[model samples]
Target: MNKMAKILLVALLAVVVASCGGRKKLQENPGVSAEIGDTTSGIDPEIQAYMDANGIVDSGRYNLSDPLSNKTIYFEYDSSALDPESDMIVQFHAQHLASTGGSVVLEGHADERGTREYNLALGERRGQTVQAVMSALGASNSDVVSYGEEKPVSAELWQNRRVELLY
Candidate 1:
């Protein structure tokens, strides 16, 4: 074979080998499943204690119509404080988490009216505030994330300022 042709063949072989190795790695680590079990049979003792303390009844299965299904809570302009309605929403989620021992991600967001850095800090503060309330209500596992003004749900500024709970 010509030298140039041999070099091209070798390069193609290397590319194929690298791609196959990546496929092998993906097959080896298939990642965790997203499916949740239907029954709450083997809950941790501490979680059970928390459920009892919070007066949460385990109905064996999660209720699709539960208040925790309401994932988003709005905030006033430049404020991280929870109003009465938001407080009630957070409380409901906290009770669900305590009962199910499930983790939650509090994603904080802000409108595009402020500096990016300031908005990011405000978003973080909002998420942390929700996390604090959840923890105080016996829900332990939570993460606070700030999206700032990067993700907007609506053109209206009031609608854009919000925190979303992700399970």
Candidate 2:
């Protein structure tokens, strides 16, 4: 290879190597940060009631509020429409913003009672419902997102049904 090309290749390699080693030339990346609290240990009271009504326990639940789950807001049956209840849920999240500087993800979920794609759409709507509330409450829209997953509504996986507020 020519001298100029060789030098450029070396520079590229060095940049890659530096990035692998955590070099800060390109801004060492800003600060950083799940689904639910550890249900295997126990569950929060409100979450427990949510689980009980749905015939699931928080134990071993993925998205259920176990200890430190970001929190979630569930929509009415087959509906993504927001309500007064969702308002209170977003308020707590607003407080969370004051303590931590981080982006948030909203996961939308639906009970496995419909087609996978349809359920997924319903789930996304569920997440969007909450995301709207958060954005309305002053949270940045760019930092929030939701995925529609056909998660069961048992305390076991019900945690997955509600919008997952992740950081």
Candidate 3:
């Protein structure tokens, strides 16, 4: 064979050998499957503890429309601080993301009382706060976006100030 052909053949052989080793390891670990269908597996202890404490069950999947599943976290007017209930909701989402290796987009919105610029910044802060909590809980793939006063959920001012978790 020519020199180029020989080099290509050697590279292909190496890749095949590496792939076979990975397959062997998966086969040996009967408890671990190739697909991540179990939310309890491969989770950080801290995250698991938080889930247990909050009584948040990981059913291996997330349903946004479920009544128990809280997708929106409302904040107090002009404040980004998360209340106890919001904190719990964030914890649940963080645990799910960490366990499933899924991604989430945190959309922040603010009340229409403030200037557009001010509201946008507040919205961003809210989103970042949620992102920080999720990251601390081992959910690494998260993005934050600020909609500010541009998007309001309801006529009520309280409903406008919120962060929504989108998976």
Candidate 4:
């Protein structure tokens, strides 16, 4: 192959390798547990395959209409600092973002142990953190949004600590 072709091939391989499933610990819910809580079931198998091949676990199209609960990227109890576990999730979206040709929203939240302002800033920081990683990975800047703590998945005050990715 020519130099250009070789470069393209290598890049593609990198993406594929980056998609491999990790060796780190993971919780396996044998089959359809709550169905709603079954995050893996929601993602398209093809997408999941691609993600797995690229080292992503929770970053693909989960039929939003199917009642699939959002994949929660947890943080330390009272902080929005992106936990190391969240990197894989962020990476999956970043790669998918390359194919979508559009923007994404990174909605941030806190786990409920902090003051509102701290939570807001924490959320934004979480959002911005995702934004930065996505940008670094492959996504464009215009594709990210940060809705800090304004929207909660549950009415109960305890459900607000989260950072949701809306693509």
What's the best-to-worst order under lDDT? 3, 1, 4, 2
**Lowest lDDT 10-residue stretch of candidate 1:** 32-41
TM-scores of the candidates are 0.61, 0.49, 0.61, 0.54
Q: Which numbered prediction scores highest in lDDT against the true structure? A: 3
lDDT of each: 0.67, 0.49, 0.67, 0.53
Model 4 ranges with Cα > 4 A deviation: 1-72, 142-150, 154-159
Error of 2 at 110 (Å): 0.3
Stretches of candidate 2 exceeding 4 Å from the true structure: 1-70, 98-101, 141-149, 153-160
Is candidate 1 or 3 superior in lDDT? Answer: 3
lDDT of 3 by residue, 15-98 (tens): 432433443343336356532223333533443444455455654333322211456888888899976446655765675567
Q: Model 3, residue 41: displacement in angstroms?
A: 28
Q: Deviation in angstroms for 99 in model 2?
A: 6.6
Write down the worst ten-residue block by lDDT for model 4.
21-30
lDDT for residue 60 in candidate 4, whole number 0-100: 33
Q: Candidate 4 local accuracy as lDDT?
A: 0.53
lDDT of 4 by residue, 13-120 (tens): 345434433201111232434443333435444445544554545523333222113345555566656543355455555655554455777777775555667777
Counting clashing residue pairs in each candidate, in order, gives 0, 2, 0, 11
